[model samples]
Target chain A: MAYTKRIDGRKFNETRKMEAKVNIIKNADGSALFRFGDTIAIAAVYGPKPLHPQHLRNPEKGLLRCNYDMISFSVSERKRPGPTRRSQEISKVSEWALTPIVELEKYPNTVIDVHIIVLQANASTRCAGINAAALALANAGIPMKQLVSSVSVGKIDKKVVVDLIKEEEDYREGEGSTDIPLAFLSKSGEISLLQLDGKIRPKELDEAIKIGREASKEVYEIQKRALKAVGEEK
Target chain B: MIAEKKIIKQKVDEEREGKKKKREIAIPGEKIVSGKEYLPGDGTVREKDDIVARRFGLADISGRLVKVIPLSGIYMPRVGNIVIGRVEDVTFNGWILDLKSPYSSFLSVSECPRYIKGDLTEYYDIGDVLACKVVSVKHKSIDLTIKDRGLGKLDKGLIIHINSNKVPRVIGREGSMIKMIKDETGCEITVGQNGVVWISGSKVEDELKAKEAVLFVANKSYIEGLTDKVKKFFEGKRGGKK
Candidate 1:
């Protein structure tokens, strides 16, 4: 468990390079492109419009649905097109992460659909997807409690690290590695998403959460700036 | 920029005194008011004793009532609002119109002009544009009528779709914006409340200029002195005439 520098030359508590833009898709109600290091994700939001399949309409609040997909060439090896079980689970988790922030009661009986497409994958695609989706929702002008920001933290070489890349993710599968992805409502400081893989002690978990929280705050500032840029344009 | 800073400083001072400010942008889930002193309205929700904003919008307070005016969103169809729609489907009894809202509107045979005696398709076929009014909206269904004046088939006009919320800005204060475009470009323009705009001019240049002016209004609607800016923009294209 010797201390070793990350492959990307980032500090143990440091995250990867991040870039985000809003209103990138013309036809969609709202859209955003988000990049964290080498990983990139694009999200588009449609509706709060009428829900299809008459029976699925909720009398009280609108339904929020998410679909997470990875392009065939996103990975080093070509991925098969279409939804797999992994994508389905990620979609459900993304939907759960976003639903709490949306004010669904305002658009009762309608459906808000969020589509997240990963154009590149080095790691932390889900976290990047959540960030993009939040921007898209804001760009779409959907009513919500606040924008959500997320980051993935993990233990590598017996040290806590923020924003894991693909190589770090692979390392987590062996021996003593843990991956924790966390999301929060930036304005309210409320935790909207938390997922863990592998094993980590309570002390490490606390440390990971603290690092993730700080990283998410930085991401939230970027989200606000992107929204303001689009607002100023209008 | 100095004047803008002064205005912002004055607003901050007013806010410190607990006076309700006008046109403050509110982010989603941000608390607008506490206790039962204010009642929540549009773009806001009542959570226990607190009224919180439900979206990104401007806070509008009228006496004890508090509401949020959303800056962006899709058009929610309302009764009696005039909308421009494209015929999507031709049915036996009616034509399904895409009003650009979440819901499709129905223009039934009964609602069509009584003068039409033959097949409905022959009168208003698919892909035709129509200016219609929302006669009724019930649940998921929206009923439209085209029998009134200027509420029938639109022929050979350039259609421009904008943000539904910007429809008001396009029309401007007391119809000033629309009138300005019409006078300058000499194009017949019909703006639908649902964010659909139709422009037809005697010349191609006039049509393009009208489109350009409407888009400029939509883009710079939030800025001050937009009417004068728009006039300058149109005149600049016409060799600075007037």
Candidate 2:
């Protein structure tokens, strides 16, 4: 059922307009919400002060706890609210992607919790959540080394795509193309998270990664503006 | 010689009267030390060797001058305030709403005395404004309770966005702005710094006015002399009801 327009009317390397909001939740120590087309994620930060069970204390830097959740109505099919096995794994990877970007050493023996609520899902909700989590951490006033941003690039019908929207994913699946999601820290130019759910040629994979990096770097600007806008509003 | 003496007396009297000219503005919570008045829009000023204090309890991070007023007893949730929340959530227990602060509060259905059942989709949806009491403030989490009249799911209304830090300004001195918006628009507006504002009124136009009024107050909250601006916005408005 994929069509020529399934890849969208844009060039293969184009990405949808991305926007972000910071300090969106008044009660969150730090909070942010990110939007990429139809996908939306709201992230909140709390901690860097105390630890549970005392044994969980790091004694050095703050503990990073990340929980990824999806509302029932986020997807086309209503998902029962709670963590599935896939969500749990995604949460772990998200925490790892964010751990190094934050200056946890500045908050010794404390805990910083990152909660990501996926309000809508298109194709790259997890990656979108990663970026939102970083913004929320900064919004919570949690000292951070730098902001983390993410994007997805894939190959569809032998054509390299920078950011894949939902229809693109569907079309690629029909065409037997490769899909990969990547998250990067803009400051260090480091790849914090990489996931592949489809097949692609090795050379095509490299191109996808290159596109992902560039897209993430660009998305970083949106993250910065969101935080800055929140401050200006204050 | 008699006319010259009378003219000199009148001139001296006029000069003395001019020196005593003073304007006394109402200082609600501040103790008047020397000067009886202040310049309009003056938030921070020095007079008679005494620093005129601002009206807010928190130090002005904006570094602007504000008139001093007594802090009222009403609870106005701030952006970073560690407030108590209750379990307004049904399934997965209620997620604690941290009151737009760093600490997370719980909205656990399990915390309640009764057992909630079914798919639980309709019981407590998103943006259900519930009043919760803060129980603890550890870095681990914030404990809260919703077993009070003030705490529960909110019904239909308008949710307005405003700066959480300026919540005090929107409410005004002794709820002056809040009362005005409520009286003028005839709508009940509940503000959440998390940017979830619930405004309830039968009239759609009233709700819109209340929203605009909130955004207005939120922007100019720190500046002095805002009553007239608010009054003017409400005057001669018709169409929302029609």
Calculate the i-RMS of every candidate, to one decimal place: 2.3, 14.5
lDDT (Cα, tens digit) per residue for candidate 1, span B60-122: 766557798777789988888999999999888899999887777999988977666668889
What are the runs in model 1 whose C-alpha is more than 4 Å off? A4-11, A49-61, A78-81, A172-174, A187-190, B1-25, B31-41, B46-51, B58-67, B91-93, B110-118, B240-242
Candidate 1 chain B: worst-modelled 10 consecutive residues by lDDT: B13-22
Q: Please identify model 2 stretches exceeding 4 Å from their true place.
A: A1-6, A172-175, B1-242
Error of 1 at B187 (Å): 2.3
Write candidate 2's Cα lDDT for A1-234 as tens digits: 544453457766667879898767766667788888889999988765456778987756778999999989999999987889989998999999998877677555667789998999987888889989987776554445556789888777767787778766776345566668798876568899988877787888888888888888789878766754642453
Q: Write the per-residue lDDT of candidate 1 for residues A42-144, one digit (tens) a residue.
A: 9999997778898998878899999999999999999999999999999999999998888888777889999999999998999999999998997788988
RMSD of each: 5.4, 16.3
The docking category that best describes candidate 1 is medium
